[model samples]
Target: MTILVVILALLVGLVGGVLGGQSRGRASRAVLDDSLQREAQAQAERVRSEAEAQGRELRAEALRVREEASRLYQEAEVRQGQAAQQREQAMADAARERADAERERADALRERGETVRERETLKQDRQDTKRERDELKREIERLNRRAEQLDARGEKLDAVEEKLEAHEKRLSEEGTALQERVRSAELKLYEVAALTPEQAKEQILSKLDSELEDEKAIRVRAMQERASADAKRHARHVIAQAIQRSASETSAALSVSVVPIPSDAMKGRIIGREGRNIRAFESLTGVDLIIDDTPEAVILSSFNPVRREVAKHVLEALVQDGRIHPSRIEEMVHKAQDDMKGFIHTQGEEAASSSGVLGVKPGLVQLLGRMYFRSSYGQNVLKHSVQVAHLTGIMAAELGLDVSLARRAGLMHDVGKSIDREIEGTHVDIGVSLGKRFGEPLEVIDAIAHHHDPENGETLYSVLVAAADAISAARPGARREELESYIKRLENLEHIAVSFPGVQSAYAVQAGREVRVLVQPDKVSDAQATLLAREIASRVEQDMEYPGQVQVTVVRESRAVEIAK
Candidate 1:
């Protein structure tokens, strides 16, 4: 509300100021108009006065005009005189100007005439220049035509010369060849083989055949060679296929079980615990009863697989008889031990008879029977030996090796394993020493020593033994229970062998018994491959601990061929 009042007051003040200014201007304008009117009146009055004064002057001028007319007449007379003099002078000057103009026109006409002549001369020069240009054009055209004709002739000559040169070169080559043939004919004629034309021809044919000198004949020979190679290849393929088809012996799992009993009561108690019962049982059977199960059941463990089996039966018998006592246990145990021995002997005889392993001593047979108690890498050594023997026989027969030697080597390879726990050195060394001392063949001894050392190259039989052992051990799931450290050692054996330069790939085959390394052909030379194989084998020996030995094989191959069409 206060602002509104202030605005109203300002508007009122502005309106009043505008009205006062407009009124003052109007009053000033009215006063100015009155003053202008007075000034205009004064101007009019002054103008009237001036007009009167001008009228008076006009009257005076009229009088003066009369006088002036007289004076002008006189002056006109004098001016006429002076004008006459000036006209005369002007006429003279005009005459001179006309003369000068005429002179300039004459000079200009003279110069134009000279210029016209010069222009004609220049036109003549232009015509000459045009004629010279035409003549030069004709000359150039003629010269160009002549040059073309010369070029054509030169080209023809050059072609002829090139033909002659080519012909001469061909003749020279033919002549040289003819001269060489002549020299050769002269030389051949001077040779010891004096010959007529027919004889020479025949001798040449004979020489071609003898020396394999003719390319066509060589081609025929190559064909024959290829055919022969193909036949050999086919034979090899057939043999390989047949071998694949043939039945092969596989590694056998050999495990032993030792059963324990509860008490001596069970033992003869196996015999029925009485003198009468003991006598009856001893008379009935031959078996040993161990009444002591110190901490456990009756010890029913033995090396002889058969004896152990029989002992099992005898114990079963005594248990069935239900006799109980220390004496009876003794009786039953004795009978059981005896019966078990007989069973073992029979089994040995049977094994020998079946496998054609004759001349085996009974004591040795018993010792062999004890193998039932022994195990190597979860395998019963005796059974493994038997499997190895069979595999060796089959392989030897197929490969045309010594079948009997291979089988014997395989069977005895692990013989030292039986006492290895009790003896020092590797089983191979021990078995070799044992075989040598026992008067076995040198071959057998060597085979035993190098069975695990194929690179030893001591004997072929050793290689066969090693191969058989591998075949037995490499079958699926065979030796699966090997110690983790042993398996890792075998893996490391192959890893070390393959770690060498140039090997592209490596496989630990034959239950880690062999490392087959494939080397880059471009990188590995044949000599280098051989050295690498030897080095890998050495590295396996020095860096790895493994059962048996590892065979390192490095293979490198290169091929070259040319294709013609």
Candidate 2:
């Protein structure tokens, strides 16, 4: 039984061992499977990662290729545009060539026609000369024939004269005897009437004086009427022509320059910390920057326009760059100053060129450029000078003077205004001094000196400049004055005319440009009226400070009335 039980135990133990082995095998297999699954998952993740990276690379390559294609397309478009522009330019060139050819042909034709006309005129003139020569010969022949006939008639007349002389002698004797009888009769009548020769001569002289006085009065009245009519017709025609020939536009200028800001916040930036930025800017640029209640605006003020301009540009740069500091401000100010010099020179060159004034000294041109920022009575001095130049040139052309010289004088006329603030004398004096220093011509210097108040004898060029200056200043909207000043000028003009002895009344007309004086006909003769007008004009010129010229017109009338009773 023990053997059998041991056998059973061995069998059971063997079975249990077998069961354990199987379980061990199963656990090892399960472990192997789990390890294989994990390896497979790791391999799959490696493949997925490789695939994702490849996909990303491919996408990147595709994007690069697309960008390259787009770049090529843009380049092509640019090339196409360039080609089109080139083609258009070529077409324009062709058109211009054609136009030039046509113009040349037309000019040739005109020249040919002119030559033909000249030949024809020459032939006609020769023919006229020949005809005149023949007519003169014929006239000489006729005069000779008349002289011969007169000689024959003189021979015939000599015989007839002998007989007529004998008859005339008898007639003379009879007349003398008749005159003696008449004289004797007159003497007897004078004795009987108790009259002497002296009294008769005195009466005759008085009658003659009365008749001569009447005739003199008639002639003087007729002469005055005719002269006045002619003077009016001629004066109107000349003045109208001068005015129509010159026309220009006027622009107003101000002393202050304005810079625009993007917003109110920029004001604080411009002010900077403790106002150091602004203070530095002003000190460097010599301009006052006024940041006030004015929204989005900054005002730059300085008597020196160049400094003001520099400050304006510097401020604009600081505001735009969003950097406001002392160092940056200084840098900008220096840059602005450099740029301003170039700009000012360019402006001067342009002004000189546009005014048709050539050969100007560079220094004078620079001085003239300063007028660009100057204002006189709200009128830009530069613009006014340009306008004067144009007007002067026009008038000079009409009057057959030197247009270039006139234009030069007009352009430089106001150059002194630019430096007047720095100089110690009047603009005229400074201008004259500058002109002399710069070796300007005598005429230009004279014009600069005497444009405002011409002395007793001013050059024609000076007069032209004065006239042009007046025309430019006196045009509508060209210049403006304070209301009080304008009114005072007008009142003064009228008062001057009224102060004359024979002036019954005076009126200031045409915005103080003209004064009309009415004189009593009895008190002022026609000649006296003319003198009075001149005297009034002279007085106004001496006493008043006015723009443009004043016209003095004196009126005198005579009336004759008859009563039909």
Candidate 3:
């Protein structure tokens, strides 16, 4: 029994030790679990703090973006308002320009209408004057017939007077035979009565001288009346009307072209290194490049207007492109020449249309267009030609002739002048050749050749062209004359007037359009002074070549001057 109790105590002790070790292990595990929970809570607090900081930063950035967007919107609104204002201003400017253009158009139309009215009135006046002239011519014829009848009656009266005188002579002879006896007896009685026969003969001669003075007074009165009537019936008014009917503008054109540069610096560029560029330009264009002290300007001079014009275009293009060299100059010059040709064609078409001419050949049109660059005595050839065409048409209409043919002839009349410098011939001859070369009608060619030679103008169309040319060239300020030529013409006029008899002094006045002469009163009577004026005018017309007409006025005054003594 003692051994069994010892073994059971040992087992109990061993089991108790096992239970103590289990309790200690369970307490350590619980402490470890609490430490772990605390660590996890701390980590969660750190994560939340970081997340709040990120949210604040995001809000701040969003506010900045919103402000920037607002500022940009404000700027865009301002820009839009400015754009709208500019557009309104532009629209206003356009409207004003359109209104101005319309006003100009209206004014032009009004002027055209007024011109038409004036032309019609002139035509009517011319017709009326022509009728009056015809009537006056009839009156002159009647006067001439009456004068011839009076001459016949005077001859009959002279014959009757001669017969009466013969009868009186026979009677006187018979009376003398009878009176001889009476005279012998009377003489004897007179001697006795102390009377003389010479006193009776002297008394009879005094009575005859008084009768001759009375007959001279009657003839002077009749001649004066006839001269006054003839002066009133003259045709000077018709020529004045024609001159007034066609009036045109006068403008001067020069054969020089001015090219504008951007600045003074460009002058050097054009001159180039050692002036090679300018030399090239001049050689290519056949024009002189005159670069003087004038600022930003160059002068191109050439006798040939076409060359000057082409040079002007080339210079302008080179200046604009800013590339000036030999190769570039050659290129530009060629281009300009081509452009000039095209421009000439267009100008010809415009002229043809404006002048109311149609069916002109293309080659002829080109030639006509070239006339735009040509000038005559400061007058543009093209413009003068156009004016001539219109005037010819008007005169042709009045004469009941072919208006179109007249206009065509007139327009082509001076075409030869355009190329006369190029070819070796007179303008008239060149024009005739050109017309014939172009297959123009014979009448047209004849008109061209005889425009200056009115006597050779066979067709009425040719005559009209001649008249139109004169009207155009002789209009006031239509052409320019050299100072030398003008002085020479005036001198010629005075010289012609002085060559006439009874002219004490001659003066050319009114720009050589008229001449006045002072005549000796004793040498030229009142009736003779009238004849002197007509004679002087005739001499002037025959001896002088002048534009328009010249007036010859002869002055004669019987002073009877006694100084009021």
Candidate 4:
């Protein structure tokens, strides 16, 4: 039984084995399939991943391309903008060049046209001149013929005049005899009717006096005409000669002199020990010592003319002596100042002789000569006075006025300037007093006084002197220093004006003679502007150096805004 069971079991085992083997095979196959599927899935997943990666790469490349394109577009836009700006600049340059070229062309054309017109005008003028010349020639010929005819008629009239004179004398004798015979017959009845000779003579003399007075007016007019013509001719000749002459530019001598040194070692000696030498100079001579920027020159300044002269001489002497010290400076200054009085007198005399004004009072001449130390408009006052005197004398002689008086008055007009610093009156009044004290006549004194003040002069001569003085002063380039303070004065005026609350800005125009203020519209009303303008004008008058009245203007503005669609 065991054997039979074993056989059956073996068969069952074999079948089971076969079935198990098939199952194993099937499971192995399943395992293999699963592995294949997994591998395939992995491969599919890798393929999908690769595909996705490729797509992503494509997308990235596309994005990079888009970015690059955008960058290129941006670069193009920048280049376009640059080109546009360059083009605009080029266009502007071209337009400016074109405008300049057109203006030049137009100016050239205008100049050509002006030249043409001028040439045409000259041609017309020449034609007119030729026509006038022809007419003059014709008139001259007629005058010559008329002169010859007048000569012939004069000879004939002379013969007739002699014959008529003889005839009249014979007739007068016969008539006289006839009248005597008739008068003898009628004398008995008419002797008492005849008047005396004295009565007839008196009446005739009275008529003659009236006629002489009437003729005096004609003579005066004729004399005036003749004098005017003579003056004009003389003036033209003198002015022409004067203008043709070469004039020396006479520069006034400076009060200061610059001394040059060989080396800088002299500066120490000039300063002396402890600045004593400079102190001595300042104390004795009263001149401020300015030592700067100069190789070896020391500047001397003083308002006192005499003191300045003394200091100059002392410094020169000290420089020459080579013994520069405080004691030496004091000694030299004393000697120099002592010698200055004689110098003043000699200089005054020399100036008078050079000016051809003799017989002047020595004191007055000295005063007059001191004007050399002063200047007006870069011209020495003494020299200018001489020139004015000469001019006045020339004009006076031409006008038949008193030339000597005019010359003396003109020369002494500003004499008081010498002592003006010491005086307490106007230079004009002081000058007049000085002139009168110096034996000047009433006319001369009046001239000196009334030259700048014309209200008091009663004489024609005084009027003429005043006119000449003004002419000399008012000539071009005749005054000193057109003051810059005038500008500040104008600015101050404007500042004072704008100090008001409602005023926006102020401008001083016409050299401070007019003030124009701009006012805020909301702050200042129209009526207020007028009142403010008047008030500003009044204020300027009170605080200004203006010769004439000031005109004030106030401006206000309002603006309206609108939008248009």
The C-alpha local distance difference test score for the whole of candidate 3 amounts to 0.83
Runs of candidate 2 exceeding 4 Å displacement? 1-219, 225-240, 456-458, 482-565
Cα miss at 449, model 3 (Å)? 0.7
Question: What's the CA error at residue 184 for candidate 3, in Å?
Answer: 38
lDDT of model 3, residue 95: 97
Please give the clash total of every predicted structure, in order.
Answer: 34, 0, 0, 0
Report how far residue 415 has shifted in candidate 4, in Å: 0.4
RMSD of each: 35.1, 33.8, 33.5, 35.2
Evaluate model 1: give its TM-score. 0.35
TM-score of each: 0.35, 0.48, 0.47, 0.41
Q: Return the TM-score for candidate 3, rounded to 2 decimals.
A: 0.47
Estimate, for each residue in 1-565, the C-alpha lDDT of model 2 and write its tens digit. 3344454465557556655665768865664655655665575566566667777887899999999999999999999999999999999999999999999999999999999999999999999999999999999999999999999999999999999999999999999999999999988977987778788778879999999999999999979976985786564443344555666665676568999999999988888889988899888988889999998999998877778878888888888999899999988888988888788778889989999999988888888888887888878898889878888787778678899998998898888898899869999888988999999988888888888875532677788788778777766556665556777788888888888898899999877778989999999999999889888977986799765467899989889999999
Model 2: lDDT equals 0.83
By lDDT, rank the candidates, best first.
3, 2, 4, 1
Which stretches of model 4 miss by more than 4 angstroms? 1-257, 474-565
